[model samples]
Target: MLMRYVMSSLRISLLMMIVLGLGYNLLVTGFAQTVMPERANGSLILNDQAEVVGSRLIGQENRDQAFFQNRVSSIEYNGASGSPNYAPSNPDMLKRTSDAVKEWHTQNPDVQIGSLPLDLITNSGSGLDPHISPAAAEVQIPRISKLTGISPSKLKLLVNKHTEGRELGFLGEPAVNVLELNLELKSLMPE
Candidate 1:
C-alpha cells in the first residue's frame, strides 16, 4: 500500500509539471502569437531595406547631433531596465546629474540650462524608457534643426506627427517615442 501511494504521488507531480509548466506556457505563447504577433515578437521596427533596426519598445542611445537625443539612461540603454535609484542628496546622483547638465549645456548652448526639461538631464525610472515628454523633444528641436538643416517648422511638424497621446486617453501623460521619431527624422535627411 505504501508503494502504491508513492507511485501515485510521483505520477501526480509529473502530470502537474507537464500541465502547468509546459502546457500553460505553450497555450499562452500560442494565444499571444495568434492574437498579437507583432507585439509577441518584440514589436520590432524594420527599416526600408527590411533590416531589423530596433524595437519600438526599448530605448537606445543616439548621440548624433542631427537626431533628437533620448533621456539619460543609467544602463546606457542596454535594455537591462533598472535605475540607480539614488537619493536626491546622494553624491553619486549629484555628480551624475551635474555631468549630464554640463554635457547638455555644451551640446545645446543656445538653449538655456534652466529652460531644459528635467527629463533631459535625468534617467528614467526604468532607465530604458523610450519616450520623452513632448516638452523635452521641443527643447531639442533647435539643436536638431541646426545640425540637420531641417527647418524648425518642419521638425515641429514631425514631432507632432510622432507624439503619442496618453494611454486610453487618460492613463498617463502624452509621450513621444524616441526611436520612432529618430527613424522618421532619418528619412528626412539626405543620404
Candidate 2:
C-alpha cells in the first residue's frame, strides 16, 4: 500500500511539472509570437540606421530641451525595475512633485505654471510608462517648438498624428507615446 501511494504521488508530480511548467510557457510564447510579433519581442524602436534605439514599451529620460519628455520617473526610467510606489500622503512624494514643478518653471519660463499637467509632474506607477496624456504632451509644445525651431502648428500636427485614442473609445484617456514622438522629432531634425 505504501509503495503504491509513493509511486502515484511521484507520477502526478512529474505530470504536473511538465504540463504547468514547460507546456504552459511554450504555448503562451508561441501564441504571443504568432499573434503580436513586435510586442512579443519587446516592441523595439529602430533608428534611421535600423539599429535598435529603445523599446516602445519602456520610457526614457530626455532632459534635452529639443526632445519631448516623458513623466518624471521613480526608477529613472528603468524597465527592469519599478516605481518607488509612494503614496500621495508621503512627504517624499510631495517634495518630488514640488521640485519637479520648480524645474518645469525654470525650464519653461513662458509657459504658465498653472497650465502644466499633473502627469508631467508625477511619476507613473511603473516609472516606465512610455505614454503621456495628450494634455501633458501639449503643455511642452511651446518649449519644444521654441528650442527646436519647429513651428507650433507643425508641432501640433505631429502631436495629433501621434496621439492615440482611448482603448475601446471609453477606456483610458488619449495618450501620446513620448519615445515615438521624440524619435520622430529626431528624424525631422537629424542631429
What are the models' TM-scores?
0.97, 0.93
In terms of lDDT, model 2 sits at 0.89
User: What stretches of model 1 exceed 4 Å from their correct place?
Assistant: none
Q: List per-prediction Cα lDDT, in the order shown.
A: 0.93, 0.89
lDDT of 1 by residue, 16-107 (tens): 99999999999999999999999999999999999999988888999898898889999998769899899999999999999999999999
Residue 137 of candidate 1: its Cα lDDT? 96
After superposition, candidate 2 runs with Cα above 4 Å error: none
Local accuracy of candidate 2 as per-residue lDDT tens digits, 1-191: 99999999999999999999999999999999999999999999998889999988888888798889899988886556677788899999999999999999998898898989999999877888999998888888888988888888888999999999989999999999999998888877735
The all-Cα superposition gives candidate 1 an RMSD in Å to the true structure of 1.0
**lDDT (0-100) at residue 33 of candidate 1?**
100
lDDT winner: 1
Q: What is the lDDT of candidate 1?
A: 0.93
